[model samples]
Target: MKAIEYRLPKDFDKSFIVFQETGKFFPCPWHYHPEYEFVLVTKSTGRRMVGDHIGYFEEEDLVFMGSMLPHVWVNDAVYSSGQATHPADAIVVHFLDNFLGQDFLSVPEMEEFRKVLRLSERGMALKGRTRRKINTLLKQMPPMNGLQRLSTLLTIFDIMANTQEYDLLASPKFVQNFQYESSDRFRKVTEYIMQNFDQDISLPEIASVASMGVTAFCNFFKEQYRVTFVEYLNTVRIGHACKLLAENDRHVVEVAYECGFNNLANFNRQFKKFKNMTPTIYRKTLAI
Candidate 1:
């Protein structure tokens, strides 16, 4: 389950990388790279795994990921069988943190752009009008060069930074665990969590997955992710509960227990804290 650290292709003449991918399926496995990445899936339906987050994805899926963040999109089984009716397509952009010069983003004019970069550590799923704007610019980029290319890119960043229509992909606490992923320990932790998050995940158990004593693990996790181990667990459990509440017909209490929440009261409280709504209200919104 260890993720591959990917290396981007180099071109001596280029300042950044912008390209399109068309295929029967998205082939890259769970992987990480140093360059910040922006991607738009124009045609496909699948599930996306970003950092500690797991969720479904489909056409118009647009995401921006920070340097060294891990991500992947696994297409549905129909695409895997090689008998798909339509080819998959996507536009991807890659640039280094200092691609625009170390001080470029520090300028006051680039303040919002800086925030986009910082928030990208958790990844961002662009939505609504912002996604539409970026999609249009990306389509216009391939045929343009020099200032045209550069200006369009800046515009895309501006839209992303100013727009409110986006979802942060991963929890701050969970992201730190991936900071030092050279060792397989981070990989093991992620794989173990994804496989077993449905059941109760205790601090001691998850700490063992990271190969550290519970106390040492606590210190390490806190320093790395800036969140206590228990808070991270609750975030994961709550995220799972949200999916079930929106997509399944189960009773609220049943969804609570199934997502590893101990009692109905606690489940309701955490759901409200995490989602700012009750389970029934969340379900009703989904129905809309």
Candidate 2:
């Protein structure tokens, strides 16, 4: 649901649009719109899809997505099932490319802001000191008006332009051309994976989620992603495994099973295939 379903700042008022949203979980289905967006996740953890990339997200995640990039912050399904003890919350900011007029950013004084806009086209994740600075500015924005609001917005952009403490989210080559049918099908399949990736899920059960036979679903999914469904599931598991490994001194074998691998040897082999390192070496180097 989009367009008429969601309220936005009225057209012709071009300063900026900022607000706080809270819910059982992020409810917007995987969708895209023309506004460039910056979101601060104050609470919740789940999968985030940007362009063709899929990955887990957690609390305090701050990200910028370019106009029409097709993305979603899908909370773990339990949140909607009344299993999550707390609700989700976020501070969201949005604006158009030419909100200040087409020529405003072309001026020499706005050079850094222009660079930020360009880099943000690939999507961005602000981390470390930059994220801390933004979190402050975001909290300070809602009560301000007129010149104060504009000033706060400029300061936010200026900080983002100057910082090296950010990572781009999507690949440079990634392009998403939306097909509603495919998005709907994958939504079911991916939600199933994200909700149950730690448990053993049968291929037939997963195929049924998309209303396809196992062979057809396997072939279709592989062609779309260029990796088998099992491989993709392993990648997701390995990602969570890396998170666990980084957070504590969990033993490698235990981490493997915690992430859905049936055995230590198999987990090691898959981890090596995806990450080019064994679990022991991975946790030791833990830079991700």
Alpha carbon lDDT of each predicted model:
0.78, 0.75
Work out the TM-score per prediction. Answer: 0.66, 0.58
Worst 10 residues of 2 by lDDT: 172-181
Candidate 1, position 109, lDDT: 89
Give per-residue CA lDDT, model 1, range 71-121, as digits (tens).
888888788887779988888889986777897766888776776776688
Residue-level lDDT tens digits of model 2 in 1-288: 222224376435546788888989988876777788888888888877665345567888888887777787888888877689899888888888787889887788877666667556557778999999888888777777767868888888889777778766554334323222345887778778877888898899899998999999999887554457887788778767866776789788888888888999899998777656687876664342
Give the runs in model 1 whose Cα sits over 4 Å from its true position: 177-265, 268-288
- Say which candidate scores most in TM-score: 1
Give lDDT for model 2. 0.75
